[model samples]
Target: MSKFILNKILPLFFLAFILLCFNCDGRDSIKKNHTQVLEENNLIQEFSEQVTYIPETNLETVTDTLLSSGYKIHIKTYFNMDSSVLKTRHQDSLNLKSYYRNGLADVIISTDDNVLFSKTITKTFIRENLSKPIEGLKSFILKSIWIDENTALNGTVIAIQMEYCIPETQDCLTFKLSVKTSGEYQLKQL
Candidate 1:
C-alpha cells in the first residue's frame, strides 16, 4: 500500500513540475517580444526627431531643364526612404559640421556609408586653420541653384554653386563654387 501511494504521488509531482516549466517559458517568450517591440519604437522616435521631412519632388522636369540649359551634373549622393540623419551612415560627418556661423545648421542627405549631401552651407572660418576667421568675409553663402538627378542613371548627382557673398570690409570678393555632390561636403580653402 505504501509502495503504491509513493508511485502515484511521484508521478503527480513530476507532472506539476513540467507544467510549471512550460508556463515559465511562455511568459519569458512574451516578455522578450514585448522588449523587442519597445526597442523598435524608441528607434523610430529617435529617427523621426533627427530627420527633415521633404516630399519627393519630381526630378524629371528639373533634370531636362537643367540639361537643356547646357549644364551637366554628376550626382555625388543618393537619397532614400530613410531620411533620418541620426541613423544615417554619415552621422559622424554630419555632426562634425552641423553648426556654422551665427548658429546656422546643416541640412544633410547621406548617401553611402561615409558620404553626405548638404544643400547649402556657409563658409565662415578659414579652412587652413579653422580657428581663424576668413578675412573680410563675414559669411560666404553657397546655394544649390539646380539639382540634376538624371545625369547618372544608376545614381543621382547635384551641382552646388557659391554665387553669393557677404564681405565685412569695403572691398568685395566675388567667387563661385560648382562641385558635384559627393563623399563629404567640404569647402576648399580660398
Candidate 2:
C-alpha cells in the first residue's frame, strides 16, 4: 500500500513541475511583447514631436503680380556642395559692402515705395582656399514672410539659403535661392 501511494504522489509532483514551466514561459513572452509595444509608442511620440507644422496658403498669382508690380525681390542663396568653411576672399568682399544690413545679402519686399520687409542672411563660400573648388557652406539665418491678410484670404512666403567652404581650396560655390509663397495666390505646392 505504501509503494502504491509513493508512485501516485511522484506523478502528481512531475505534473506540477511541467505546468509551472509552461506558465513561466507564457509570462516571459507577455513581458517581452509589452516592452516592445512601449518602445514603439515612444518612438512614435518622438517622431511626432520633431515634426513642424506649416499653415496652408494659395499665393502664386499674388506673388507673380507682386513681382510684376516691380517689387524688388531676391532669393536666399544655398551651397550645393558639401563643406562648412568660408573662403577668405569672399568674406572680405562682403565685409566691404554696406547696402545690405550687416553687410549681408537681403531679400527686399516693398509696397508703394515703403519697405514692407527685408531679410538679411549671411552666407559663407565653402572652399579650401580662395582659388579652390567649392564643396559646401552653412547659413545662419532663416526667415518667413507674410504677404497679405484679408477676410477669407491669407498669404505667406518662405525663403532660405545656406553656404559652405571646401577643404584646402580658395574657390567657393553659391547655391541658388529658394522662394515660396502661399495664400489666396495660386502658387505651386512644394
Candidate 3:
C-alpha cells in the first residue's frame, strides 16, 4: 500500500501542483509585467521633462512650403519605404536603413513663372557644415521650418530645425539651418 501511494499518488499530486502553477494568471509573471509597464511610463515622463520643447510641423512632418518675395520654396523629406532589406537583413545590417531614412531632402524653389532651383540634398550637406561627425545617430528628421523674413540680420529668410535621434530613444541633437531667399542654405548645431 505504501509503495502504491508513493508510486501513483505522489506522481498524481506532483502533476496536479504543476498544472495549478501553469494555470495561475495571478502569478509573479503578471506582477513583473505590470511593474515593467509602470517603469516605462515613468521613464517616458522623465524624458519629456528633461528634453527641450520643440514644435512639430503638422504638415506631413516632412514637408515645408513658404512664399517669400514671390519665390515659392518647397522642402520635402522622405524615408525609403520601398527597401525590404530592413526585414530580410540581419540585426547587424539594420543600420543601413538609417542612411535611406535620414539626411536626404528634395528642395525646390520656384515662382509663378518658372522653376528656379531644384536639387536633392544628401548627408554630405550636413557633414560638410558640421565640425565633427555625429556618431551613433540612428535617424534624423526635419522637425520644423518657418519664414523668418529677417534677411537683414543674417541673410536668412527661412529658418529650419532638424533633429538627429537615436533609434527608438529620446537621445537627439538639434541643428538650425538658415536658408536664404535665393535657395542657398547654411547649417549650424543648436
Return the top candidate by TM-score. Answer: 3
lDDT of 1: 0.37
Per-residue lDDT of model 3, residues 150-173, tens digit only? 542353355655666544457667
Q: Identify the runs in model 1 with alpha carbons over 4 angstroms from their true place.
A: 1-105, 111-115, 118-120, 125-134, 139-157, 167-182, 186-190
Off by over 4 Å in 2: 1-67, 74-103, 113-117, 123-171, 181-190
RMSD in angstroms between candidate 3 and the native structure over all alpha carbons: 11.7
TM-score of each: 0.25, 0.22, 0.43
The per-model lDDT (C-alpha) reads 0.37, 0.36, 0.54
* For model 2, the run of ten residues with the poorest summed lDDT: 52-61
Scored against the true structure, residue 124 in model 3 reaches a CA lDDT of 59
Residues 1-190 of candidate 1: C-alpha lDDT, one tens digit per residue: 8897789988898899999887776554565654365565675344333433322431211222224423343323222233212212245223221211221223344433433444424344223423444564444322223342443233434333233333222333333232344533333332
Error of 2 at 11 (Å): 99
Of 1 and 3, the candidate ranking higher by TM-score: 3
Stretches of candidate 3 exceeding 4 Å from the true structure: 1-64, 82-103, 111-117, 138-156
What is the lDDT for 145 in model 1? 30
lDDT of 2 by residue, 26-125 (tens): 5545656543655656853342222211112211212222544444444343322222223222242132211111123345555555654455544432
- lDDT, residue 149, candidate 1: 42
Candidate 1 weakest lDDT stretch, 10 residues = 95-104
